[model samples]
Target: MKRQFAVIGLGRFGGSVCCALIEQGMEVLAIDQDEARVNKYRDLVTHAVVADATDEQALKHLGIRNFEHVIIAIGDNIQASILTTLILDELGVEHITVKAQNDYHEKVLTKIGAERIVHPERDMGVRLAHHLLSKNVLDYLELSDKHSIIEIIASTKMSGKTLMKLDVRAKFGCNVMAIKRGREIIVSPQATQLIKEEDILIVIGADEDIKRFEHEMFDE
Candidate 1:
């Protein structure tokens, strides 16, 4: 059976996480104090509950500790967010992922034993900066502080170049992990495989190498 999960606080970040989890076929319970917000996603998740995350009795009633993972995405209310995380920790929730409003909030979450903390707004800002620099950058994912995986639309200049001809690994120090052509995906493509116009390339490498590849090959 798929692992069950719960998301507390139906704000932007929590709502997005719940939607993505549901789309991935997970059993997600969306929880929020606001009835309107809970009703908004009533049909999107396996369950939507209107309850106060800070109320220990309410969480226990929902069997919050039984879920494999529970995400606390409370908005700007730092104290409530921390208290909810602390309560989850006390209840022995399997895994707790909390959204931090800022650096200070992250530190507190860390101190409270949060398994994972996400700074969604800050991360999105970083992704947006890269998009503004290039139109071909369809998406960007940071793998580490210095490495990333990025998606780009294969340009007309690269439409006919085979992997052997372009030699991104040898020249730009990046690896094309896969190519998406229309509805088909070619993963771990052979060197003889050629690029086609409108194809999407999923490339991974150090941030600097990716920048060089984009400027020299894709953008130029």
Candidate 2:
């Protein structure tokens, strides 16, 4: 079944989400106060409209509550985002995800019952910092503050070692969830699978343990 989405605020963040959802074959209603932004995405989404999201009547007229998920991506205007989220919650929208400008904004959204909150800038910064600090780490995603999924290049020392020999789970408290080499990907790689140099290992574990594994596996 195709899920319906309503994206309010046609800023960079919201616009990207709208486009991505459309690409995935989901129905999207793109809303923005700026006419130009709405026009830009008019053909891309199922519907595009220029309206202030903080206006409850405008939202109601658009049948926003019918959407499975609504993303509040109002940039800069924290007040507008909060008010819009509050109205969506009141209207019983099934799920609401909000983009927060800061900690205070996130707290306000949490109090108002936003289902999820994203800090895109903060997350990007963390990923970039990790990549710069560690040559082996290609990408990092925070599942929580404590746990993460990381992609790292297989080190020379691990080139011929298998999962059973490394004892990753028992020794480092990490798991190699997948292995990617060139165009091939192996999901739930076997215990006997060898780690070849240049192969990318997708590892998941607590943040501390992941860091420890990185240091031990790829110390330079």
Candidate 3:
């Protein structure tokens, strides 16, 4: 069965989520107070409606509680975001994801029982900064506040060495979860897996451990 999702506020982030969810074959209901925004996505999504999500009666009329997941991506307007989230919670929406404009907004959303809160702009900035931090650091994914998964392009120093020889886990506490070589990807690479120059390593560990591994392997 296809999952059902409702995205409130058809701004940039909400619109992107709607598009992505549609691409994944999920049934999405797009909502916004702006008629133009609703009309823009009317044909693209499963359903699009211009309604004030802050209105409890409006939400009930739309049967918002029926969706398995709902994302409140209201932009800039913290009060409306909070009110919508509160209403969704009271209406028994099982999973609620909210986009927060700032730390204060995030705190209020958390208190109102939002299951997930995201800072898209801040997160993208962090990812971009990590990409710029090192030439070898190709990508960074935050798993938590302290842990991350990073994709690093192997250097000449790591060439001709096996995972066992590198002893990365013992020395740096980071795990090389996979090795992407050209067109092939080796998931859960063995300890004896050979490391080749330019092979992309998917490493995961605590932030500090990842930093230590990067410095020793790439910086030095």
Question: Over the stretch 156-209, how does candidate 2's per-residue lDDT look in tens digits?
Answer: 989999989988898899999999999999999999998899999999999999
Q: Which scores better on lDDT, 2 or 3?
A: 3
Question: Largest lDDT belongs to which candidate?
Answer: 3
List ranges where model 1 is wrong by over 4 Å: none
Give lDDT per model, in order. 0.93, 0.94, 0.96
- Give model 3's TM-score versus the native structure: 0.97
lDDT of 1 by residue, 36-130 (tens): 99999999999999999999999999999999999999998999999999999999997999999898998999999799989899889888988
Instruction: Report RMSD (Å) for each prediction in the order shown.
Output: 2.1, 0.9, 0.9
Candidate 2 residue 101 C-alpha distance from true site, Å: 0.9
Candidate 3 residues 32-136, lDDT tens each?
999999999999999999899999999999999999999999999999999999999999999999999989999989998999999999989998999998999
Candidate 1 is scored at a TM of 0.88
**Rank by lDDT, descending?**
3, 2, 1
